[model samples]
Target: MTTMDLHSMTGAYALHALPDDERAAFERHLAGCASCAQEVAEFAATAARLALASSAPARPEMRERVLHRIGTVRQVPPSAAPLERVRRGAARGRGAARWALAACVAAATAFGGTAVWQYERAQDARHDAARAERQAEQVAGVLAAPDARTRSVRVAGGAGTLVVSAGRDRAVFMASGMPEPPSGKVYQLWFDDGGTMRSAGLMDPGRSTQTVLMRGAVDGASGVGITVEPAGGSRRPTTAPIALLGMPA
Candidate 1:
């Protein structure tokens, strides 16, 4: 069978609707196929949800009706030669039950898929909110420093400033009168701690006055520098720095 054929059977396998032999074959196939395994897991979860939804207490009249039907129903032995028609009727009944089950599973899968999507969206939103909150706190701390110092440096076509907190562990960079860099390049910030250089953050070249929070600690840094680097910035300064300024002692 083609891979597509095998993949198509995942729903049936998940619902245990596949015959015993086909079920065993699909199980072996599932071990080697990551895509099929994921699909099966999703379908299984949906089936579980369906089972939970079906666990509600039955109505009293419905229970009584079921009991009455069971009491009135007659069992016929399959070995009875004259009962061939009864066997055919039983087969038809089984077919109807299978169709009903397939329909229920399809509905449950749709609901489960929607639930999973909503959950993922909520998680992403929470992550973004938390990140923004942390950044705000950092900015507040630096701005509130009792002895925060600012240094201005001249760039090729503009100027920039470095604001370092009194404690010296955090800093922010603000650029002004600066023109955007050429295409395929970006402005990058760096902290020179003692003699070692560390990447601080990336600045938007298009903005004439852009403020960026430094990514690296500047506690013992002697100075800060801005350099033009390839898009996405670089690990180390690769081009001549556009501006450099020393921190106050």
Candidate 2:
């Protein structure tokens, strides 16, 4: 093969797009040609960056849109006249070579941007997963505590259970058969430490059975209470509690 033909095949070789026979031939040539070997190394690095970018999850419709575009787009071949002109320009002062290098630089820049965006998205996914795991472990610890005590409380339309571990200062609240709250209202949990009540958090009432780790201190709480309040909840209970359970004496 001519020197130019071998040089042009470096990109295809780096991308693994060459046929088996052509790839074998290229490898043999690459062993002796320092310039072609260096070009292949740079192209391989660019391909790795593009691969990283494409590893991210795509939107649901992205596959359909990409396939539609591929089917509709027309491929244009380079005209001999323009090719001849470019050859003449390159013969004079390497203008065509500079243009090819510029095109490679632009492609590399685009791939670099995609790689950075995909990396950030991967990091965010990892953080979300880690946070969820920690929350699950906290709930598990409260449920498995050997010193934990549990009590059930009956409400107007449903029943709930409170499990507390004084050794861990943790508590878990679970509700069953609870109906959805009225519009603009939610169920809120409270921990009664002596006679003072502290907010736990708003509960999800739509669930037939729901379990959540209480956010307030359980170490000194005498009992647990659930009350109905406006959406986003209130600093103090706005209505009489739906259920209350005293801790084991």
Candidate 3:
């Protein structure tokens, strides 16, 4: 690979996204490329610092959630050569405490630098996340809202045809054209997992077919479902499903 390609892959490499062939090539380059390896180290350290910026203000629940998410991703240890070098120097010293203090100072400095870098990255990540969420909500609003004169019910073409962009604490629905139900009954949305049913929202009949449908966050309907119920709606579907959609929780 060219030097430019190798340099560009540093971030992806740190994230471990490179394919086997690409990873082998990069590792081969890194073996002889001190500059590239150094750059990789810096990027990895910066990523670690970015993680620190997301650190909560010492709350138990927040800490638990953070740890849970962190547990899903593989942890990459920081380069230890600097610490090793310090330890060797400490070994040559007459007193362990003095060397230990020096080592602590070094660690503190490293952490401080990393924390600052991570704070900026965290801010940037937050901004990006907010922007993405806004765009998503706007799209959801458009899909859910039907020009103020109507309501919508999302009808997926098939299983896995719908994608709902929702946070863990929120429920969201993305759907397309669905036929209106028969008289004396309305289409009620539900979240069913092959067993019990939970109400999502009451989908109003559209003036015509082939329209968009969106639903706000609702309690109980963690999964998506549709069933025919009373005009006003039902707490749960009493009959079989008219349609259903689901996503992993």
Per residue, candidate 1 scores C-alpha lDDT tens digits across 1-249 of 667777798777666667888867776666566566666667665665665445678788998899899999997656676578777888998999999988888877665665454334333434555575677788777877887878888877787777888674789887788988889999888888776678998887688887778996786888888889999999889988777889855
Order of the predicted models by TM-score, top scorer first: 1, 2, 3
Which 10 consecutive positions of candidate 1 have the poorest summed lDDT? 117-126
lDDT of each: 0.75, 0.76, 0.57
- Ordered by lDDT, highest first, the candidates read 2, 1, 3
Worst ten-residue run, lDDT, model 2? 117-126
Between candidates 1 and 3, the one scoring higher on TM-score is: 1
Off by over 4 Å in 3: 1-161, 166-168, 207-222
The whole-model C-alpha lDDT of candidate 2 against the native structure comes to 0.76
lDDT of 1 at 201: 89
**lDDT by residue for model 2 (1-249), tens:** 776787689777666667988877777666556566556666665666665424568898999999999999998877999989977876866776788878877776666655444344333434555565677899899889998888887766787888888888888988888888888889999988787779988887566578888886776878888888998999999899888889854
Q: Which one wins by TM-score: 2 or 3?
A: 2
TM-score of 1: 0.61
Q: Candidate 2 — number of clashing residue pairs?
A: 0
Model 2 misplaced stretches (Cα beyond 4 Å): 1-122
